[model samples]
Target chain A: MTAPFKGYLRADGRKGIRNVVAVAYLVECAHHVARQIVQKSDDMDVHLIGFPGCYPNDYAFKVMSAVTTHPNVGGVLLISLGCESFNRERLKSAIEASGRPCEVLVIQNSGGTLSTIQKGREAVERLKAIAAETPVVDMDVSELVIGTICGGSDGTSGITANPAVGRAFDWFGAQGAACVFEETGELVGCETIMASRAITPELGAALEACVQKAEAYYTVMGYGSFAPGNAEGGLTTQEEKSMGAYSKSGAAPICGILQPGDIPPTGGLYLLDVVPDGEPRFGFPNISDNAEIVELIACGSHVTLFTTGRGSVVGSAISPVIKVCANPDTYRKLSEDMDIDAGKIMEGRATLDAVGQEIIDSVLATAAGQRTKSEAMGHQEFILTYKAFDPLGPACLPLKRA
Target chain B: MPEALILLHPTDNVLVCRETIAPGTVATIDGEAVTITQPIEVGHKVARVDLRPGDKILKYGAPIGSMTKDTPRGGHVHMHNMQSDYIPSHTRNASGGAA
Candidate 1:
């Protein structure tokens, strides 16, 4: 029998792998002050994360609130530029009502940048001391929500790291943990194969529709999902790349389709429809890997499994990311950034199942609070671009209990 | 080890190099020794037989691209000699100047 792991339980009834106090700046003007506070706090758990947009966006507000109240965040310190459009009072109230400590430091009212930094530092120190006392409870694998993403992909990505993640996804799903795989734009060619793996016909249709939305969005953006570097790395077409990327979803039947902020109703496989609904208002669905990581965190993923063939080093603000290297040569060059070597598959040394088990073990270890390579290296890469998403249609959430 | 190069699909006329092959390296296919004249990177491909221009470069049993110039037996195949037959890619103007 596996030993039960201890997890930090938040007031919102969610479990987190780490307890962190987030210092968030409301706009770009207050960003420097927030960074200073986090730096002065000298606490690894005290992290700086913020939105740079001065223009108010409802999606940004929702994501910020969700992150502030996330299970991983033990407390929050909001920094505002005083003239920004974000409603700091409501944000503070939401954090306070969640039973977590929160403080707002307005640069204009707090005597400018230096003074505000001093005050913000004091607030963070106090929050850290309080958060240090939060209790940890016993948790099981079934309660874990894991998200998977592939970046810096090459020809070997699908054959190795992706399929390995798929194997882990299957194991996690079987163990009752919710698993999410994203980048519908990357899943263009595998639509039929992906739909066939859905648990129900309705879910199958939803999966197809999400892919269609991604294809339409990218088409308007004037590019196939295929990238030039992808060709340089030996990937030929969009569909071929899709086949490789789709392998990360594992072989489990997709139980539901989720938009950017929609949380999964239960433990099962979910396809995150990252494309915005209707006409593409946002320039691109996801500007980069970090954007997708933010969306996964908003959907309640406690940890993320990132697969790469060309190599990527990124960790999110609210969750830890486990990097799986797919290319043997790239792994040699970036060994420190990677958590697992699925390249053994290419070397003819390890089978896909063996690497898959390794990924599952890594997930359990990460959930038990083991810091991933990216997390330990202080790689808190976060990005939130502008995108419009209509509420999920009824067909998208057929599995949810009404 | 199966071979220095393996055809991933039956219809493929090109074979992916399983390991690095230097210029003048001799490799056997179907029990025949074929001498290479150009170095090929691992994961890159080489024409299995003489190929004419406009012929599809098949790998993994699919058309990866089309040969821009005629390639000889055991010749290295890459961007310098092959081009994508799908949507033509360009650096300055990808979508015909549509921003």
Candidate 2:
């Protein structure tokens, strides 16, 4: 009930734990220049992220717009290759309208990569200066938006880290915080169980249908969206992995279902349906863990709880990722990358509730500016790819419709 | 069971090994000791009870897959014996998953 964290209040009224200056490239051609700008800035708070397509997509625009104005982002510097189909002006105007300091540098107009990088570095300095003066506001637990994703999962993920995250989610629910768990591809087998936990029957049906869509999509792609490390790590089936992945939801009632770029309107548990609506224009719903993290970030998650049994060490650009090791063996191998030792639950040395509290405490500490292991290790990875959507059905956006 | 073996749910038909179990390691399950038939790696599953082929494999109290071959108590349960009823799973080099 107490506001224990102080957040940078954006001009648009959203609060952010990290005021990052994002240098986004409009297409793959400008990626080098954008990366150079951020790398040369020597500022940990500045990051590079971009889409690779030259084709303009409404879905891309929507996600990019939402991400650029995300609460974690204070300012944006868009780098365009000048000839790509991506609408830089539209993206720039959206950021400006959000009252964030944003500008676009067309590489061709700037003469070349060197010129753009130099201009981009100066832009980062100005953005950082603007970000520094942003007002700090006290935020309550109720105002926090937390997300969970499981990557490189194995057998222990379900029994330990995933369930522990679920327990932390239960605490977040008790504190009235908005929490999100995602990857419909990973939630395939647990749809019925997941739907039963929905706040309403309509929402339950909507949740089932989303998983159905993901199953069909992945089936067409010739793979179950699982990785080889998963098997080596002792995961036998995709649905089995889904059951383990489902544990991160804890036992909270599902309040709503969302697509990327759609922020939760009220505090409760929600499901983020990352699969594209129409035909699978994108090869995979999520290319990797960071892709899914980006969608969660697009939904305005302040921090992400990442469970990895095969030892993935990725942090997001816009939000800090708290890595929870699910296997005691993997934990020993990559202790430096992990924030919480949920693996102890598997070893019987620690109870689930204890590790769950550790996760919640990590969230509070990260919000209070104590960098997570990933953040302190400077793992600012990001990726945004193209996809299409046919708008949400009647039941998906309950809060927005209500 | 060795402290390393955990039953996620009362209804689960498999036990998750918290650490690798060498052959001949005896685990006390439900107060009964069962000797490991084969080496089971950490994070792998072991049959909690006898199961026939086509029987549903339950973990986390949910059906993860189905047994492709009969499995005995204390036997290692993985892709060799069980497979997902949903979309077929793949490793890095193989593509012959059941569709």
Candidate 3:
């Protein structure tokens, strides 16, 4: 008795909610060329995404590969400056082997800026035609991977948007869909309670240790996880904020901990440990909300649940972000940018369960190709920064076969 | 209807201004009309009673930060006169800062 949702089927037997052609710039140098190609194409499915770093990084390589191979991407066009550190050949081969059409245009080799833009535009047009030929298939909710993140947080974020997302997460997990939540740095005080929900004893310890690592890293930076604006917004302590933010994970048993590029082995609840594996090489784990979203997409999320009290307006390159507004006033002011109004819980207009159901409905609708506010407004924010990670500990992925 | 500025706990000496309070505006709390001496931005807090320096700034029934200078009753409480107790945040340090 449920309505059927339609999805695009990729050649690798994966289902995609959105069939998008990803135009990627290998480094910051080629960003303009990539942008010009997307702009000239004027296609809704053509999205622009890339790394801005001139230096090569393992994390960047992994993220780029994961994004290009994401189910949502129907094709990929790599814009290289010819001298950048990103492995363009390997990336092209990976996308090609995945049965998606891929093209590489080195700016230096393709004459100069004007000539390269012409060639890139031609390549994109060709890819667009090929991307249109991908097959459409019926998809079920069970095959979906959803990620949750909170930004521009205020006191209401935990009380409203966070819990509402938790409700949706619970529903998704019950339906056998994988739900992921990250930012161990933000979950400092609630680690003990969170670890208790781990499905296995080893996963529980790994959960605790990840939070400890975030605490240590933040301390070295001479700051607590708490921000000044958070204090101004009625949050008293770092742990208190953590307690509020942690609610977005819902009450599901933790399945395993995944790093930035590590995909979930099976469908269930997963925790992403975004902090670097060794000493902090990058200045901060996530410089902004878009960076975390990029990591979630790299982990193969089809869509993202973004909760905010201060009102963040960002959509992803490969995945659609559903914005849940936490504050009633903010929702009224920025309703154009938000998808769901969670402030109803505080105003006594709606119950948490009702809001949760609303989020679940939104997810299903979005999976069936509903455009979120950010997506409608064309907020394709993307960012990838340098990070080091030791592989997930054995305890982190208990489901992995020996 | 305008939302009420709630005091999360009875032990808390300060209350959050859930909505913006303009300069010279009067707000009623517990049926008492308290006149605002300065503007208090939404999400910021106001002292329910006069407090000396070092008194814990409470919201949600917990110590959020500490008062740097004496704050009068119904006065705006923010960064210029408040400081975090857990870790002191630095701004524009000339030396030993990020290069």
Judged by lDDT, which candidate is best? 2
Best by TM-score: 2
Q: What's the lDDT of the predicted structure labeled candidate 1?
A: 0.82
**Candidate 2 residue pairs that clash:** B1-B28
Clashes per candidate (backbone, < 3 Å): 0, 1, 0
Query: Taking the candidates in order, what DockQ does each have?
Result: 0.23, 0.71, 0.21
Which stretches of candidate 2 lie above 4 Å from their native place? Answer: A1-3, B95-99
The stretch of ten residues in a row with the least summed lDDT in candidate 3 chain A is: A227-236
Among the numbered candidates, top DockQ falls to 2
Ranked by TM-score from best down, the candidates are: 2, 1, 3
> Taking the tens digit of each residue's C-alpha lDDT, what string does model 1 give over A248-304?
988888888887767789998998888888887868887888999988887889899
Which residue pairs of candidate 3 clash? none
The models' CA-based lDDT, in order, is: 0.82, 0.89, 0.83
A291-396, model 3: which lDDT tens digit per residue?
9999999998999999988888889888999999988888999999999999877676887899999999999999989898899888888998898887777899
> Please, what is the TM-score per model?
0.89, 0.97, 0.86
Ranking by DockQ: 2, 1, 3
Better candidate by lDDT, 2 or 3? 2
Interface RMSD in angstroms for candidate 2: 1.6
